[model samples]
Target: MNDVRLYSKTDFSKCQLTQHPLYSYIQTFLNHDISCLVENCRNATCYAIEFGKELILVVDAQFQAGQTYPTSLRAQYLDYAQEELALTEIKGQKLLSGAFRLLKTIVPQKIDEAVYVGNYLVSTNLFPNFTLEEVQAIELLLNKHFPNKTIVYRSQNSFLNQELMEHLDVLDYQPFISRQVFIAHQAQVIKRKKSFKKDCKLAKDTMFDIRIDFDVENYTERIIELYSQLYISKYSKINPLYTTVFIEAMTDAQNTQFIGIFDDEKLIGVTMSWSFDGVLTVPILGYDLSYPKEAGIYRLLTYFTLLRVNDEQIFHMSSGVGPFKLSRGAEYFPEYIYYKRVPSAKGYTCSFWLLQKLNKILIRISKKKVF
Candidate 1:
């Protein structure tokens, strides 16, 4: 049996995610202004459960409008679906595409109530170790406080043991893959792909300076510029808000690593990576698309990202770009977005029907069968 102690507010600050330099750096880097690492959420309360002194689970009991709801609840999945299908380019049908993007922005404006476990992007493993009893304990605690609301527990790139499989009604989607470039075996890893090999050489031939742990102000406009390109490339509605949040995170030097790629004193690319415990996460990365593709700006940035990871440390490349990631020797794993809710009143069901209609319309517009 595991000895569990519940922690909340300031008490949870001593946990590994915050104590370890890497995790602390990235969380602060990402949530600086949009949210705080150790305070009440914009529309909720933040809490955690610990076993002895090590933190086991962290969650937010959200009850109103907020970033996590509008972004994570749906827009993220839509962005991935669109990217995978390569339908980001808005061409001849300007009015239709414009309306679609507008709907994407409006749909997530309200989330009623929910509990989100793991981090915002759900990139890290929330349960390092698991048991049915422990899961039940946490559920009961949440149920006691917000019995009527929905619970969304996201576990990215982690195993779902038999106990959890049996206990929760899991909603499985497209698998989310986390990429890593382990520096300890860089030589072997690099040889896996001919293109990667070529790209690395191209990167070596190019002249670009990569600086780490810098000021957000120096590259604020550049970051926004590159990110906007990425936003159009991905047809992302979540980009505007995330772009703002990311700028705020880049300012915290203690918890953020801001890598700026410059050519002759002009910024060309930026990769923002955060670390916690021994794990590193590259949540935001952007480069000027106008630059020579052969210059391999992306390849150079990726090469340096791998250099930061060693055998003992893990790197989370977040999600998407399946074949490219696999070619580079990054392992793939399933990430689930679990939803549990008690039977709701008639009005809630009506809202569900309306959401279904919106979902179907989106599917039609994207020409992708999500169901």
Candidate 2:
């Protein structure tokens, strides 16, 4: 390929066997996918062949400006085995490496260092009997590409790390970070479900019936209204990825499920959750700040929705900040992130390494406090 050009999400949506992901999480949390994130810089217009063997989506950020797609690719890989999939396996589901691999493959511009992005972990069919060697292949490929870049993943427990570094694994898999948190899936071993009743009585007194609805489109404006109250505050900033249009896209009846807190006639709060074959994801949630003194809506929303869900055993709760989610009866979880850098090549290696270590330490220290 000459150089990867940009392909609009619409264009890619037309590919055969292409299933557009519920972009809520990415849209809500990330600025945009690879292309938009690098719009000002030169990048690739990659075509994914399907979440294939050991890989899901392969995003070629284009190729080197003058280099050819060499007959033999000196590349490195990272996938599910040590990422989100790694966490899944810890929870007892069979896993194969297929999530995203940008961390392993993104190399510096000079020195023939080119990076590729991939994540194939999310599969409709469960992959069975996964071994540690699959991750070895990913690491070897990534190291080959950068030569100097170090591969680091916070989700790795020691046993898995040793397996990744046999003598054949020549590249240095540096310890750039430690003790990262994997955000807990809400459905992992559900305990007895409970919701405080006093909150409901308060709603009843206010003359609004508290009803939860799966049909989110019925109240898109209200959903946005509550979301804005939660997000448009001193601690919040606007995310271009989650425009009103994107929110509407998520509400497309065919795509997402919503749970709303309503008065007999007025909408008061909303929580939006999504489902894959087995995993339920909560991407957006908020309550009206009008009830400032009481945590009623926050606690009430969780209870109603948690109890109503048919399968609560495999849910992924997006955990962040603290105090509120920590106390609302949802359990705490650690979310993991990894990075690759070459000190000599790009030279962000050591600087970033130190930064990650202190950040991890701070996070662990903060976790001690709960409401």
Candidate 3:
């Protein structure tokens, strides 16, 4: 028989997660709180849900207006209008901005209440084998517990979680393409791609040394700094702002490896890879941007991490840098966010429906553009 067990912050000790593979990583959030990992989601509350043998993390948040992108429904769906509009190279930029401003006005309605299943605010949420019965059970439990909140499942793609997504779709959940992600199968990436071979050669011939074994304790601050330089400073600030505490806990977690790139004695690049089932994802990676582009610090880091993917493991390279990942034989797929509003959320029906329409339009627009 399939059953669902939910564990809140106060009752976390009652759950038996010691035998779970991700116990340590999950405990890190429970111990120091999730705000240390994702600063924008400080108001979010997390819970652990056990369905059969699978353990899933749930993040519930009441998103406020003007909240940053990561945890904000308005920012992701409505604010993204600016970027989506830019892709078409339309002539009237100010008009598009004005339209977006008008749309943002309805963002703070009842749509703010959301419950994200299997959301760690990471690049991908690796799912275990969830039967259809399990999905239905979990959905029922979430609907009962979260009442008027929108239940969401993020970071889903056809390549990795096709069956799971199909189950949700059949259950009447609306699918929205959140972003495009790259996944490299070990067989295809290692055997077929000539560019991958070249990347491997470049990685080996690079002046920087790749060190798999390092004292993470000594370099916790450095890791945060390097990661911030790329993810926060260069990329959008909406990305998770990981602190030293998160880094320290991740280093000590099981099935997780942190690789460091050294230029002589100075550590210049860092990448951390974690695996579950047969999937491996490098959620944390960064390098010193001061180095010339020719240095290939990022390339070296990617190559070394790709090497960790064994014969059966598929590497979830996550989103962005489509051309680079494509050259290395990574297949692109649209990652989706599947959501369903509870019956009590009828007041926000129009707002939710508008977001869904916008998401569909964005997906259609993105299909024409490469990446």
Candidate 4:
């Protein structure tokens, strides 16, 4: 078995990641502290670990400083609990609200001691193939290094990481459904969905011009502003608040592709996506919400995104906009965060056990609504 080696920002160059596929992305992560680029990641520290051919990014989050769900475990579980509470309130489920309120009080302190393996701090963290031996080796390494922390692997779903999830399950990791994500295969969606066909037609008929070959560097600030308008303003501020520096790094990166939707040569919408192992994931997508809805800017962007990827590849649209994604023939799958309780950290273990139970109930009740 190959040895597991860890690299910090100070010595990341020694890992010789220049030849790696995600070199540019990893370099950006190290050069600029991830927290500065991502607002919710203030309390967490990132490290890279090399295990054979795989380069895994790890996050050590001991404090509950972030107000968002992605970086803070407390926030992650609470967000769902709160959503469930709201649903129960709407349905007059007063009996369940008390239990959820208790969860709100207990979850914050208990779930804070965690170290996430394979965390990219993005919407999705892509993984390379891992043999059972590799999984065991990495588990052992994490257990030794982070003895008092709950070991976690975030951004996993059966659609993409079935084998990895199975391996973790075999190793006694508890799987908690974090959220439901939508995935679409372009050829299939195009063939089966009438709504998708209409969207494509609308995109073609729309006045906005979609440009694949443009100076992405020149539009960094605009991209950030547009992205913030949707993701931060319209949506919850809990989402990663990406900056111009992050946009610049993405444009400079070899692996990512950018598409701009221009209204009379002015960028109104943008998407930054990357493909790995024949699967495409768009981490950044935003448009001018101020634009009239009749314009169908969002619809146009989605259609162009489908056109951007190969017909054979699957597009992981990520979570949210369930109705919109479903209209385009996207299939929903429960995304999970798998974790192993450290025996020494009994407090976190008990809290995680309780969280697991809560998640099971929440998953059952909100399954349809979440998608």
Residue 228 displacement (Å), model 3:
1.3
lDDT of 4 at 25: 77
Better of 1 and 4 by TM-score: 4
- Candidate 2 has its poorest 10 consecutive residues by lDDT at 120-129
Per-residue lDDT for 146-264 in model 4, tens only?
77788888889888899999999899888888877888876664546787788877876888888984799898889988988987776666677887878877887756888899999
Global lDDT of each candidate:
0.52, 0.40, 0.78, 0.77
lDDT, residue 215, model 1: 66
TM-score-wise, the better of 1 and 2 is 1
TM for every model, in the order presented, reads 0.66, 0.54, 0.93, 0.92
* Candidate 3 lDDT, 1-371, residue by residue in tens: 55798888788787776778877777776666777766656757788898766677888878665544545566666665465455445445567567667777865556768888887667678888777788888888887887778888888999889999989989898898888888888665465678778777888788787899588888988888898898778765666777887888888887798999999878899988888888989878999999998898888888877776677788899987788988877888988988887765565777776677667666775686645
Winning candidate number (TM-score): 3
Q: What are the candidates' C-alpha RMSDs?
A: 6.7, 12.0, 2.2, 2.3
How many clashing residue pairs appear in each of the predictions shown?
A: 6, 31, 0, 0
- Give lDDT tens digits, candidate 2, residues 1-371: 11122223445443343243523322321233442332222333332322222212333333344222210011111221233233322322232232224333443333223333332111111111123454455555555543653443333322223343332234443332222222223432223322234443554565444554455556666766677677444223221113344456566523356777665656777776656444455556778788764646676666555543344334444434444444434554433323444556554554344445544543544355321
Q: Residue 328, candidate 4: how far off, in angstroms?
A: 1.5
Can you rank all candidates by lDDT, best first? 3, 4, 1, 2
- Which pairs clash in model 3? none
Q: In model 3, how large is the Cα lDDT of residue 126? A: 86
